[model samples]
Target: MKNILVLCTGNSCRSQIAHGYINHFLKGRNVAVYSAGIETHGINPGAAAIMKEDGISIDHHTSNHVDEYSHINFDYIITVCDHANENCPYIPSKNALRLHHNFYDPSKLEGTEDEKHTAFLKAREEIKAYFKDFVSEYFRG
Candidate 1:
């Protein structure tokens, strides 16, 4: 089974959203999708709520430090933010492809509730599209 890890500054928003989509897209395809952060920040409720609106549940996912997954040999290591990508620790995995995309952090947006929701929705859509293409390109079995 192939393993994918989505990394972010905090495993709360963007990485979590990407994790949900990758798992949704690769169900039953012999792949394991995991997400972590350079620093452990609890899962963002707005992220989970936005995903739930699209029928994906990420409430069970925990805030994880990248070190927690250092033992696993990852097939792909995806960084969803610049911070995580720049500060990523050395992960010893044989030929693990490194991917990076800096998604907007909706959790950090300061605005009205509606504005926050809109930001989350936009981030979710972007993440979903990226991972859809990613799965198609890499795991098209």
Candidate 2:
């Protein structure tokens, strides 16, 4: 099994979005998907809403700290934030792979509600596209 962890500063936005997409697309195909953060600062409503636009439900996902998976093994530890890439702990010798995928926090944009949601939606789509390409390159049969 290919165990992959999508990591971010908070397990709320980018990591959660990537988790939803990977779980939707890579089911029953030997790839396991999970996401975590340096700090579990609750789920981002914007991420949940944008993913809903694509028929994927990530609303129920709770924010999770990386310590949640300390007992498990990960084949890929992908950081969706600059902070996570720099501050990760306990990397396994055999299955450790680090990737830097910096994504803006759409929830942090200062704008009208619609404008903020637009940013979230745009980030969601780009993350999905890049993730699809990454999956095709690494995990496709």
| Highest-lDDT candidate | 1
Assess the local accuracy of residue 63 in candidate 1 as a C-alpha lDDT between 0 and 100: 91
lDDT per residue (tens digit) for residues 73-134 in model 2: 88888888888888877655375676778887797798999899899988998899978988
Question: Which digits, one per residue and each the tens of the lDDT, describe model 1 over residues 1-141?
Answer: 999999999899999999999999998889898999999889999999999999999999999999999899999999999999999999998999999999989998999999999999999999999999999999876
State the TM-score for model 2: 0.93
Query: What value of lDDT does candidate 2 attain over all alpha carbons?
Result: 0.86
| lDDT accuracy of residue 35 in candidate 2 | 94
Error of 1 at 34 (Å): 0.9
Q: Which residue pairs come into collision in candidate 1? A: none
Cα TM-score per model = 0.98, 0.93
